[model samples]
Target: MINKHVERANRVITVLFYLGSTLLFILLILSGSINHFPINKFYWLSANTSNIPGAPYDISRWTFWGLCAEKNDKNVCSNYLSPAYPISPKDNFDTTTNLPPSFVSNRSTYFYLTRFDFVFFWLGLIFTGVNTILYIFTFCSYSFTKVVWFLQILASVFTISAVCMQTAAVAMAKNAFKNYGDDVSIGPALMGISWAILFLTICLFFMTGGTFIKKGYKHHQNYVEMSKYKEDALKYQQYMNSTKPINTDNASNPTDPYSLPSTYDEGYQQQNAEKQQQQQPVDIIQKSAGVIQQNPKSSVKFFHFKKTKKIPHNDDGSV
Candidate 1:
C-alpha cells in the first residue's frame, strides 16, 4: 500500500520539479536576477521594483520598447537586473558606480534590520511566528517523502535564521557607528547582509510549497492502495462464507448473494452421478428378455405382423 503512495509521490515530484524550476525563476527575480533574466517576467513590473525601494523608479518606464538604447544596447534592461548601478548615463541607474556588484539583493533589508530594537523584536519573535506556521502546514499533510519534505522544512529554518542574523549584524553595525561616530560605512555592510537574508527567504517560499505538493501525491497513492485492498479482502471473505455448511441435500435453500460460494465447478456432474446410474433400469429389462432361451413348444411365441395390399383395376365384379 505504501508503494502506491510512493508511486504517486514520484509523479508529483516530476510536476514539482517543473513547478519548482518555474518558481525558482520567479524567486530569482524577486530576490534579484539570475543571469540577466528576471524569472518573474510575467510580472516583471512588480518584481523589478523589489530591491530599489523609494528609488523614484517604475518598471513600466523601463520597458524594452521605451528604453531606446536598442539592439546594440542591453544596458537599459540590465540596470533593472540589479539594485546597484554602474556609471552608464544611457541607462536607468540612480547613481554612478564603477561596476555592478557581485550578487543581487533587495535593498529593503538594509533599512529594516539596521535598527537595534527592530532586530531583537522581529528576529526573536516575528520570524518565529512564521516558522511555526510553516511547520504546522508541513505535518498536516505527509503524502510527500520525508526526505524532500525535510529539505523544504530545513530551508525555512535557515531562511528565518539568516533573517535573524542579518538583523543582528545590521544593528551591531549601526551601534558601532553610534559609538565611534561616523568611523564606518554601516550602509554598505547592512546592504550586503540584507541580500543574504533575501536569498534565504526566497528559498523558504520554494522549498515549503514544493514539499507540500509532494505530500499531496503521497496521500493520493495511499488512498488508492487502501481502496484496492478493501475490495480484495471483501471478495475473499465472501468466498469463505459461501461454503459454510452446504446442506445441498437441497439446492434451493435461500441465502444472501454475498454469502454465495464463488468456486468454479469442473466436477459438478460427478457429484450427481448416482442419478445417471439410477436410469439403467430400462436397458436391464431389455437385456434380460434377450438372454432367456426357450424351446419351440414354450408358451411364449414370436409373431410377425402381415402387410395387406389392394388389388388394382378389378372392373368385372370378380373377387
Candidate 2:
C-alpha cells in the first residue's frame, strides 16, 4: 500500500504540472518574440536614397500589416492576408518596393526560430496529454508504480525542452534586433508568466523524485521484516523439536500408548515378578528383627526357661 501522504503529494504535483503545461501552451501561442515594428523611419530605410517614407509594419509568420503615411497628410493602414485583423486590406504593395535590410534580417531569424519552436510546442503538448492520461489511469486503474514514474519523467523532459526552445527563440529575436542597432521590445507579459510556470513545473517534477525513494525504502523495510520473521519462525520450530518428548517405543501405532505385543508384555510382567520375589526375603528378615526388638521381655523369659530345664535335669541325675 502506498502512503497516503505521498499519494496526496504526488497528486498535487501532477496537478501543478498539468496547469503549468497548459498555461505555457497558451502563452506560447499568444505571445511571440517580436511584438511590433520599430517606430523610427530610418530603421526602415533601404540601400536606395530616394527616401520615399516607408510604412511601419508588423510581420508575423501568418500575415503582415502596416501603417503607411500618404502624401495627403493622412495615415493608411492595411492588414494583408490576415483573417483575424480588424481592418480590410489596402492595395497590395508593388513588387518593386524596397525592403529594409534590418526587417529582412529580423524576418529570417524569426521564421527560423519559430519553426523549431513550433516543433517543441507540439511535442510538449502531446507529452502533456499523455501524462494526463497516465495520471487518470493511475487514479482509476491498477497501473504499476514504475510505469507512472516513467511517464512523469518523460513529460517533464518534454516540457523542459519546449521551454528551452521557446526561450531560445526569444533570445535569438532580441539578439538579431540588437545586432542591427535597432531598439526592440519583447512583449505580451505572458512570456514571463509562461517561463515562471515552467520553472514551477520543473521544481514539482524534481520533488516527485522523493516519492520513488520513499517507495523503495518501504519495499526494503518490508523485505527485511519478512526475512526476520522467517528466521524467527525457523528458530522456533527448531526449539520445539529439541524440547519435544522422544517416544522410545518401536510401536508404529499412534492411537494407543500401551499397544505392545503379547511377548513384550509377558517379558515385562516376568521381570516385575522376579523383582518382587527377590525383595520378599529382605522384607521378612526386617519384620522378624523389628518384632524381637519390640518383645524383649518374652525373649529373655524363653532363655531363662531353657536354662532352668537343663539345671533340673542335672540335679535329678546328681540325686
**Best candidate, lDDT-wise?**
2
Each model's C-alpha lDDT? Answer: 0.40, 0.49
Work out the TM-score per prediction.
0.31, 0.47
lDDT (Cα, tens digit) per residue for candidate 1, span 1-319:
9977975674455444434433432342232222233321312111122233343333222221111122221223334443322112113344323212311132334333323322332332334233434344444446324444454454445445544554454455344334533322222322343344455445545655665665677678999999999998888778767556543333333464432244435475455445445655765876666666433444356886789998776688776
Candidate 2: regions farther than 4 A off: 1-10, 26-113, 136-144, 181-183, 235-319
Clash pairs detected, candidate 1:
143-215, 144-214, 144-215
- The parts of candidate 1 lying over 4 Å away from their true place are 1-145, 187-190, 193-197, 200-202, 240-318
Local error of candidate 2 at residue 46 (angstroms):
20
List RMSD in Å for every model shown: 16.7, 15.8
Clashes of each: 3, 0
lDDT per residue for candidate 2 within 130-149, as digits (tens), equals: 66556555554433445656
